[model samples]
Target chain A: MPDRSVAGPLTDPGPSHPCGGTSPRTGEPDGRPATAPGCNGRVTAPPDDCLARNEWICGAYLSSRRDILWGAVLQHLQLTAVSVLIGLVIAVPLALAARRWRWAAGPVLGVTTILYTVPSLAMFSLLLPVYGLSASLVVAGLVLYSLTLLVRNILAGLRAVPEETRQAARGMGYGPVRLLVAVELPLALPAAMAGLRIATVSAVSLVTIGAIVGYGGLGNLIYSGMNTYFKAQVLTASVLCVVIAVAADLLLLLAQRLLTPWTRRQS
Target chain B: MNILSEAWSWLTTSAHWYGQDGIWTRLAQHLVLTVVCLLISCLIALPVALVLGHLGKGGALAVNISNIGRAVPTFAVLVLLLLTPIGRFGEGPTVVALVLFAVPPLLTNAYVGMREVDQDVVRAARGMGMTGRQMLFQVEVPLALPLIMTGVRIAAVQLVATATIAALAGGGGLGRIITAGFNLASTAQVVAGAVLVAAFALIVEGLFELAQRLAPGRVRGGNTG
Candidate 1:
């Protein structure tokens, strides 16, 4: 296991050499001493003399900015995408079982409610003993976190199906499985999507906390800025996060519109 | 037995970090942080909502703005504010972020609550020669009390949870314990901090439930009655 003792403070210097002393803008070292170059600051190490370069820019904006932006975007997408996918896989069945048994809702909702109450940082810390400092732990924590929203949404959607519709399906001699597949699932899609929307927004925000455990993402930018006291980088990351949040929200809106055409018409 | 002993030792040590004459000296610091954030948010949001609900103009714009606020994550806002001039001063940034985080629910619910008042009651009040302010205070606000209370309940719960993030920004609270626990790999500390927060949420929720129960009967049963 990676030594937890060596884990640096969330705020640390970025890539600049230790010899450079304090950055003019940030009172801390040019780069956090504990983290690698580019982990905290705008500085990029040159390909040939990666060790020697002290300047912030090693290449043109296209190469450096593109890499950092894509890195942040990709990290964010992966974190949210994995959690949502796993949450859906788990939540759908649990929701379905809750519908079938009725008794299952009590336990299912109870567990998820407790999980929801656990703060994200506390949850991450709790998992460290079992999973150590790995991406698996982060993903598992996030997936568990997403389940509350997904399950509630899915169940609400399922419960909202009219009694007449269920009776009609039964009249047609459809089994539980078939009825669920064809009727209940479609009707429940909007509510499920609403849950998915809430889960996705929540996941995007919570993923930033994963940076605390060295699981890198856009949050790393914010944390790095804070550590080194890099106001500009901190600002940049913060703005980018807001932009990303807005963009993701808009994307969901579009997705909701596309998938639930009936909803669009109602509006 | 060994684990139990270790836990006991940790608990005793933890007391040093809590209570007056402890780590930060008293719970007042955290309470102040939470209460001030809530009070400021209510003060700003309540008036805007009252005006919009009374005037019935710009209702759409006010509502749309609140909706946008819902979309903005509180943590992200906290981090973003860290970069601005205001954020440089530490806790001020956190307070600003918390207020923004809180305003939407309070504003939306207050506005909607007031607007949902019985139209005939409002008309009657007006016909009785009550001024608009008088109508709002005497008729609409009382009628809207329950719904407004519901908004406050939600805001209270949200504020409690989000207050933990303030620790990351150096605004003190139970979050400091949680973060320190994470850094130290102390599961007990983490659990303790989390349990306290959850407990706090439950207490606030229960208190709000009591408030709802005690609301003036006219407001509580006005609809059904």
Candidate 2:
């Protein structure tokens, strides 16, 4: 709250908004406060000349125009959710196979490891020929990247079920499928959930790179903001990505706690 | 296969391998950026992690804060830095952004590695009247080598991938090749640029794996993440 008159001139909130055509925030005529005498108390607006100066925050994040930001956020979430779900779906079966065959573990882990090492931008560009700049290309790359984390964790979770526990179940005449469903899978859930959390956060960040191919969720805002030198949009988009990633991570943490009561007790 | 051949042909063209905007120059630029940023990140992350791990305090908080930090996209950080006063220094902002992107794994793995050192061995060192500094440098660091190297490997490989954002920020890197290809609408060139980055990352990863294998056998099996 330091001296509004000095700060007022720097940020004018002028009519030069990118969206053009005055919105509700800018449409008000004579926004300057004439009632305040010589920059004293109860200063509502600024002097007339200040309003003509350039605004740091453009119309991109203006209240009336927030739907654009909302749409971008939804796109970001959708990209993350879809890619992570696909990765989880593919990883579970692969993890199970590796657990069973033993030999499958090497190649499965190796291939996914190589894929994970590929840069997100490089992965997207590599698939350009096959996918032709579609959002699916982004999803496809993300799913491949997610595989290593999910598979490793899922396998680790399954392996974590003690041999003694498995022996006890088998002694009870539990079938392989029944033992897996009732015992192993449930025990593996916590680790698998941890993998899911990591994968989801990674996907959220990676989706921003999809902007290069014209499919980034909040990334589009950042790209455009950089090009146009609009600070607000870039800040807004970056903040949103952080919020989404943190929120997704925290929610998954909550889910893990709720789903694995035994783990909490042991801890 | 068709794309591979096209990429190969694009890569081998003499015109693509020379001059300021050539593949070799861009590759050099990308390598320099990656190395410099990696060094800076190691400087910032390692000492902090090592001390915390030695003290056996605040390791979890440091690691968690870094995980949250990771969620901030590199590209976003680059863009934000570019719009600020710091952006005037050209490569400064890009390097800053890359350092931020690479720090978390280095910090986490180093801390985890240090903490994972055998408690009995630590007690033995203490019984022998070794100083804390001596114990940390002589005992813990040697035991932590595999995991520390694993962190370096992860950060190096990630920086190679993440360095592409440099081109967008008016800095030099192999990402310029990809962006140039995109501008020219040449799929072959784009693929070639990507192949180079992927190849570079694989080579870096391989080198780290080799180094990890060369460590003491007991430490070689240490957990990476």
Best by DockQ: 2
Candidate 2's displacement at residue A9, Å, is 34
Evaluate residue A98 in candidate 1 and report its C-alpha lDDT on the 0 to 100 scale: 85
Off by over 4 Å in 2: A1-60, B216-225
TM-score of 1: 0.81
| Per-residue lDDT of model 2, residues A1-267, tens digit only | 100010001111223323333322322344445553332334433434222232345443466447778888998999999999999999999999999998999999999999988888788888988897788998998999999999999999999999999999999999999999999999999999988988998899989888877788988777766665556667778988999999999999999999999998887
Model 1 misses residue A48 by how many Å? 24
Pairs clashing in candidate 2? none
Taken over the whole model, the C-alpha lDDT of each candidate is: 0.70, 0.80
lDDT of 2: 0.80
Candidate 1 has which clashing residue pairs, if any? A11-A227, A12-A32, A12-A227, A13-A31, A13-A32, A14-A31, A14-A32, A15-A31
Model 1, residue B19: what's the lDDT? 66
- Model 1 chain B scores worst on lDDT over the 10 consecutive residues at B20-29
Which 10-residue span in candidate 2 chain B carries the lowest summed lDDT? B216-225
Scored against the native two-chain complex, candidate 1 gets a DockQ of: 0.28
